[model samples]
Target: MADFKLTYATMFNPPEELHAGFDKAVEKLKKNMGQEYTMLIDGKEVKADEKFDDHSPVNTDWVLAKMQKGNSKHAQDALTAARKAFPMWSHTPWQKRVELLRKAASLIEERIFDLGAAMALEVGKNRMESLGDVQETADLIYYSCYQMEKNDGYIVEMGKDPLVGYDARNVSVLRPYGVWLVVSPFNFPFALTGGPAGAALVAGNTLVIKPATDTAWIVRLLVDCFRDAGIPDGVVNFVTGPGSTLGQALVDSSEVDGVTFTGSFDVGMKMFQDFGKRNYVRPIILELGGKNPVVVSKNADLERATIGIIRSAFGLQGQKCSAASRVLVEDSVYDDLVGRLKETASKLVIGDPTDRNTYNGPVVNKSSYNDFKDFCEEINQGGGKFLVGGNVKTGGMFDKGYYCESTFVVDLPFSHRLWKHEMFLPITTIGRVKNMDEAMSIANDVNYGLTAGFYGSPEETEWFFDKIEAGVTYANRPQGATTGAWPGFQPFGGWKGSGSSGKNAGGHYYLPLYMHEQIRTLVK
Candidate 1:
């Protein structure tokens, strides 16, 4: 595997050794299943009065782990620990912080197989996608450290002021905010949590991380890596529980200096409004859900468009914020492209994601499973046609878990709410357009501007890039239409309602979001 590099775009054809390693890790993980796990706060193991059992979406009969069900007190305790550690952590030299973060990234890569296996069972992602998430987390941290080093710890010598009979010196530095709170979503739990945590820590701030209820176990393993890398006590903390009690407490705390949250738009907006009620404005970075679209031109390559659309639409059961939820094709080749997509999507294997041959997996949990059914029913009532799949998979192994078939709909009116709403499931809507103008108009109509894909001639591709409202845009790529963003290669984020800071993660501009600028002037 030395000759190969792994990224979401490249994971489609990994070496045989990769599969062997994953198989071994999966076997080892099975033996350790159903253990009780505790939360880490201020370098101590904290247990809650109540606990919840985490069941695998792949097979609910298998209890993945027992996790602590923390309350508001635990959230405050974690925040307090981070606040207390802020002075020492914020004063630590940036170089030392970068060193520590790099070590943590190394540990993630070393444990990639184990982490990936647990992610597959817990998050219902396929082996390759799970491994990619783990690898991407490490790469994101590495990128943050690289940026810190490249910018010389964000310290720059500025032009000195000339004063009569005096020597003036001026310098500028970027300093960390106080304690930071990271609230991560269920999908890509490792990367989203670790990425923000790494940046906050490297920027000289302390942290308190809270994972989504459905995916606390995998995140606990991630926090372990940071602790094992010798991050100072109280500098990084982890908590688990319901969002209403624990997560809200963290957000409402006056002690929190900043926050980074990745979740649905409604929830994030509420948090943003609540956080704004503080005396002063605090930094709140958000990656809200997306209603991403794919625009295929009349002169586009039909085969490439079909593959990219199918992969982006159905990968991870289309639970990604960057998933291609809507496809707008030119009328000239709409039927051809739709037929190819239907044929390709129909052949996708669906079952336990841990299986080597499976390309599609179960939805994250029962809530999403039921939502999928409800959405399919709504589409049927609205006079939409199912091109491939629009039903839940039941009986046999699927009966024990939350499983849904990949679904694509067509002929729904443009005014349908489903066109703009984020389903966050294995459902995509495809529509025909009279021309590129019509396709582009409909694609940009949604509030989300996270990611978009285009397939067309050179001139038309250029037009799409110029006109699309999304932040991350791709053209004629078979790997994925709107998904498969890699750190350092394709820094992922959103625009408009899709994101808050207008900055993409794992790129040159992300680290500074965790910090503020300070200028020093001296005269003698």
Candidate 2:
């Protein structure tokens, strides 16, 4: 197939003859395999007659192009290719695999802006957030490579234990989970998808990837980057379709040995139960949604506190799993901070995320917009008053877009479902607490414990550090600050529906876990 490049711009550009018309968006996405999108199986391009239309959320009228959609055939092909390549890939020299992963990392770094822009257009993330996501994704690649380079194939010994001073033998090894299925989400598509993909690939695992429809454009584009980095054919496959269909196709496949998924909790539980019920399952690592909390203290610096909350709570339009949807503030500073928060939030211009001036963007689609709307109605029904923005109204065609107004509800009852729920929208609920005891009570009340953000004096910060039931807790930080994975490290999943495994990603120490060990006794 001849090569062709596609460009997705951040700004609203008028379409050209070469571009497809988008009533809501410009031609921000185009997939070209021999001049148009075609699926790849073992490096061979195959066209599908049916197409999937991907939209850009920047404008409601712009209609992104319709590209060939994958079918059961694609899922089967990905599994087939992975099965065929598994033996060879798993047997590749550790050093060679490490080198390949490093190369993939470098290639991703070079295309950071290119991929980030695609996200801003197709995925509805602001430039800063998009840039952060792309970088975090690429960083995972490098992190996996570093892990691979340091892989200790295994361990064996004939020595001491409490009961046995003399032992016959001991051993350890990392065995690949044969064929891995990575199904990513609409939010943080790159980072969530990239973490598992990079780790599974560099660990000598052949894999299939199915990203959310809202953002598969970037997923496919990144696959190209992997190819440019010399990733072997069939070692990585990209597919997208109805989740239930595609998910069942891979999970039920006899050849698939593992699954990595990031999305909603209801779906996650279904996948988990199915894997168990089928009894034909492999390992499944999931990153489910959470009602993550952020706390503000009486002694905290309101300046730092406000910046943190705004970005964390509202960044990504509150679509982040780690987005600070719950807030517990000390009564001493509650009135003043909420007032100041109102001031800061009011200053934010909610509009197209692709624009340099855009601080907010439309949600992924109309459904997410309604989710925000319905929840706000519930809050208002429960006697909460809106301090800042509360209604959804768009002006002009651009205004007609799926823009959810920034919303904050005060005076919500602690018993309301909204307080404990994970609201992945622009709406946030801020509560006032009397002291440290009340603050801890508020923070620990939720079932979701993925992450926490706290602003206070060192001692006050320790209150959360000690009592907050979460995987991540940041003190004296902004809302959106310290929320993602950096290069050369790992970010783990949290308790109570966040994930099953302890190591979420970049546990480079576990390369041996995905490997096989052989032991032979030589008789003298």
Candidate 3:
């Protein structure tokens, strides 16, 4: 497939030529906005009786696209389609499956610019982050393919049993679940959608992907990539609708064999609970929300910690589940760390996401905007100091977009609701700790344990890694404190209440979860 090798988007210090191309691509997509899209079940487009308007989080005045409002019936239809295609697809040779997925990855690379443009507009992600999300999706698919090849299609011959000395043979094979339902989140929609979906397909399972309401168009692009690569009809289906109607239908179905979900803790946990009510146990892979933390020890380098904390706390407008929402600093470095962090936060550029220089973008929608405003107000009322930003930005482009300042607050107690909850906004709470021990205590005190970061010396860093209760951890990383996880480099997952499955996505253990083991004994 044209000598494909997956590489992440190089946004920093990128050649001027790349920027020129991206700018043109954005213009092209902007002109094509407002088209209507429908559900894809069994290779046909099925329009729903109801439709929803998708507006740009960057500029709500601009209609990005129209999506079919999928319902229970649509979910059932998609499931039926998947089941219908399962026999042939599951029997397809693993080598053939690998080739088709690789072709899809190549197709995604060919259309990377276009997809990135759509993502930036639809998700309010800056150019770099949007492009990274698209590239990461392609990488994730390639990784899954690589894993399939490495494992020899998960078909292995086993040793003969001691009692089977009379000419007996044993073999093990992993077989796909009947139908896999993929429910993706808005942030990193392309990657999260493609990653889990790829894992399922590579393992021979059929998929009925339910894209987030806001990101249906992006998923449409992804489905096209798979279809163009020659995946059989009904093997990969796409449906869009509200969670109350479509989501509930998919989860309630006893026919669905497995599900991969990425979203809020409340919803993910509920799905985990409901999936268990069936007559038999059904596999559910979930990456839920996180109230991640970053600890700056007394031995930390203040400059490094400040920059890392800023990036983690505000990147993607701090919408990432792995974003650092709480920062616990040792008392010795607390003043310096807070001072530098506020300075960096104040200097960060906030504007249109398509701009190459923009460091922050708008929140996903009006609800998030209101939540950010209310959180900042509460912090102020609780006598916390707003060392940098505490208000939303309005007027001009901000009038239509859900724009807000990347905020920082101090003097909030560890028991504050803001400290313990996941705001999913560009807000970070800073508190002082007596030492590394107390910092660890405060960091792990939250219910969620998705991701965490530490800035300290080698000894302290080792201790942090040993003691931290997160699934994903980073130390002294300038790119971010808890953010910036590349697929192959860091397999992402969560611990405690942040996730239902212990296996990390894009890691070695992920694909096995999509299938169940079948042991065969042949006596000769």
Please report, in order, the local distance difference test score of every candidate based on alpha carbons: 0.95, 0.73, 0.89
Best by TM-score: 1
1-524 per-residue lDDT for model 3 (tens digits): 13333333134555665577679899999888999988899989899999999999898889999999988999999999999999999999989999999999999988888998999899989887887898899989999999999999988999987673577789999999889999999998999999999999999999999988888899999999999999999999999999998999999998799999999989898999999999999899999889998999888888888878888899899999988899999898898888898788889999899998898989999899999889998898877888778899988888979889998989987777888989999988999989888889888888888999999999888899999999999999877899877777889999999887898988889889999999999887
Best by lDDT: 1
Quote the positional error of residue 348 for candidate 1 in Å.
0.4
lDDT of 1 by residue, 389-497 (tens): 9999989999999989999999999999999999999999999999999999999999999999999999998899999999899999999999999889998999989
Cα RMSD to the true fold for all candidates? 0.7, 6.2, 1.9
The full ranking of all candidates by lDDT, starting with the best, is 1, 3, 2
Q: Go through the candidates in order and give the clash count of each.
A: 0, 22, 0
| Residue 310, model 3, lDDT | 89
Candidate 2 lDDT over 1-524, as tens digits, reads: 01321211112232241122221122233332122455667877666767777767777555554555777878999899988988998899867877887787778767666666677877788766776677677777777777665544333543333344443443445567788888899988887888788888877789888888777777877788777878789988877777767667776676778778898888888888777765554677877888887788888898888878887778788898888888888898998989988998898887777666678888898888888778888888998989887777567745667887777789988888889887788888899988878878887876777888888898876666889888766887543532553444325567777766655565544344444556543322
> Which candidate, 2 or 3, has the higher lDDT?
3
**Candidate 2 at 263: error in angstroms?**
0.7
Measured on C-alpha atoms, candidate 1 has an lDDT of 0.95
